[model samples]
Target: MLGGRAVTLTVSSLADVSALLAALPEGEAAAAAAAAAREPRLTKPAGSLGRLEELSAWLATWQGAHPPRFERPVARVFAGNHGVAALGVSAFPPEVTVQMVANFQHGGAAINQLCRTFGIALDVVALDLDHPTADFTQGPALDEAGFLAAFQAGLDSVPDGADLLVLGEMGIGNTTPAAAIACALFGGEAADWTGRGTGVVGGALARKIEVVAAGVARHRGLPPLEILRALGGRELVALAGATVAARLRRVPVLLDGYVVTAAVAPLEAARPGALDHCQVGHVSAEPGHRRLVGALGKAPLLDFGLRLGEGSGAALAAGLVKAAVACHTGMATFDEAGVSDKG
Candidate 1:
């Protein structure tokens, strides 16, 4: 079983991965209809809960069950170092990735606290802290074998019977690669996708934009999957793989902030409905994140000027999703509550 789903999927190459994405399994129609039918009979005015109602239905649609519940939610944070960090694109050094991963492992990070608060099982996957990918401006970040390895690692990260998956990433210089991937997937200039990741500003931000532009220019017009190998890191590709694994397993996904969004953006571009089972957990403070989400036509569940990676935003949003599912599953129907139907 692949992530608790009975499917035989072999992803040895990007072509295989692309083909898999192009012909992905769809969500359950009956479960979606069942959730919709149950929504209006819950003794409340129609459309009162706004996005919460949609969240419940989304959970049902993706989970393929009548009463959707986020019982076994898992949060994954993929951490990797980047060769492009040598370009001075970030305010912090690349070694920070290792430091942050240790923090997460030791339960001292914000994501750790948030995961505990929201009752999410946390998994921190370090792609390769000692070895960073090749600098994109010089050449591809990862070769075919390397990319596939990282992708498979991501695929293997998803747990069995997880009703919900929350994805995030940690890499000091990852925003540069994420911006480059966004620029390649969507038609945009470097400045349009690049932002002040790691609090770089002034000339530092300008340097980051230049680096993203150079990477895109060197590897532009490649296929969507190639764009990932050309400009993305191991953690980024792993996030994409985990997203695919979750969808294939029929588990709903809550995507974290900017880097995570950019990591999985190529899936949607390669196939339109690739991300139908996923939602933006929260919008990050990175300016490019807002534009990227807009390009994906996604409405984030929350916006609190959050820019911390490592699945923090998604973990916070998990509580809200749990509440949404609770209301959908536990609320009494009009007849059960002795409430009059809308007449």
Candidate 2:
């Protein structure tokens, strides 16, 4: 019923997702306070560590410990094909989605290398590799049953014993659907919500923008779930399910880039404050990603113009999170170091 097999679910609607979705566990405020209290007593000037200190405290609060442990950090890359890829939204063809899934399986993708470098476990979820979704510009991307199925498949992919979960996606032309969903949910012009995905420009970029505009215009005024049904691909649906599952299980999620961020957008709108359990891995080169990150009200941990999905950004940021956890737990306090506290 949870993570693993895509079993049949009683959940048939977004309301079901919300009803079954538990809010993130109330982080240990006492632990966070304890961490902050200890920081001042460490053998260093106050606030010298800057964001690292804050990150440490956040981990403490999330884990209910003054010094949290970073055990079993994992990343999952959800790969699928979008029917909108027929529109040339991305420079890469839809076949590239299948090819890249192979790359991920062979440990040749950026995310695979990054995850290996950081000693994180990696799983590539290919739910729609051979089964692409319907083109949204023409009709609903997935039927209600299909959407729920994809959602469950994604929900089941979150690994057990994971201290932190990183979510990413690979779907050619997904940016078109992501942009359409963002425009519908966030109320922005299609051009504003769209971007130069995979470096498509000039005429290709113009057509991509037009596709998004038409898709959003057709699906306007729909509810969050309807918007997803109209515009979301299998990978995006799965990403959203994974995000909801993470929040329900009290696992902190590191979202990769634009597609992942857009996938979580509807949840934030539906659950209100659900994103408190999530963080951005990076500010991607994709323009909509900035708007998506802003809408979530969370700052990215890094900004290296990364637009390559497949959990690449999340893998890079996971290392930083692990380091923050180590610093929180391993550093010597003034008392432990026999150093005098500030008088």
Candidate 3:
């Protein structure tokens, strides 16, 4: 059903994710050539549009179309409860995750407004809110079965006919897991990645750092995906899965914030270029996000000091994508307008 593929593979194992990685389609060079050819004729000085021009070509290359159409962008926010929240790592309680999901459903969240403003459909997947992951300070957050289930849930969250996917998460205290993931994947001290999630102050932020340090120390030296299973929450893993699913479907993805970036970081670490079709929608106000994006070599599309997750930043980036696509497709050529071309 997805991408008109005859075989639908379920991500029940990390090996399956590996297989998907091996099978990831390369970008369309011809479409990129087409985009490049059109960009010069679009009545603008060469390279004047900056990222908008690059964004247009990126849309063409990833969407595999001559003139890319940004019609069906979808944002999916995965919400889950983290057992690590019990450590006083975040200002908000885990129960807030469930409540926030209801807010998304009721069109009451900032993401809801962002989605309406950007014309992107928003879907929320609350993964096992009643069953929070085991506290990673003591042990693995999710065992193999639980990990696979959340990963599969992520893969399934991606819908068919989606032109692009914007991934965000709504798990309270999840920045702890996200920090842990970044620490494990990037070989950083926990304090470097841990930040004030939910506005935790001095003591709470320090405790969050300690918790991240412990989680990474306990689950270090594993494969990237295993690190993710050990340190990341359900919503994080699901975002990773949806990213894989989007790439498999040849759909581009806009990633949101530190948590979402950390969620998908393992994939790129596991297999280089796994996230080539993906871009960070914005640099989060979270301290670690700027460093994380720098590590991934992705210059974010927007940066307004936004730390609100739930795909709000990504939905806002969708508007940029639409503008990029619109300019690429709708702008008049120098020849068509009878304007002077660069001589």
**Model 1 CA lDDT for position 314:** 90
lDDT of 2 at 318: 88
Instruction: Name the regions of candidate 1 deviating beyond 4 angstroms.
Output: 1-6
Which 10 residues in a row give candidate 1 its minimum summed lDDT?
1-10
What ordering of candidates by lDDT runs from best to worst?
1, 3, 2
Report the candidate with higher TM-score, 2 versus 3: 3
Candidate achieving higher lDDT, 1 or 3: 1
Tens-digit lDDT track of model 3 for 1-343: 4333433558667788788777777788999999999999998898888999999898888887789878888889999899999999988878888899998999999999988988889899989999999999898899989888988988888777788898888988999999888888888788888888789998888888999999999998999999998998899988888988887787999999999999999999999999999988999999899989999999999989899898888889998999999988998999999999978
TM-score of each: 0.97, 0.93, 0.97
lDDT (C-alpha) at residue 86 in model 3: 93
Badly placed stretches (over 4 Å) of model 3 are 1-7
Q: Rate the local accuracy (lDDT) of all candidates.
A: 0.91, 0.82, 0.89
| Model 3 poorest 10 in a row by lDDT | 1-10
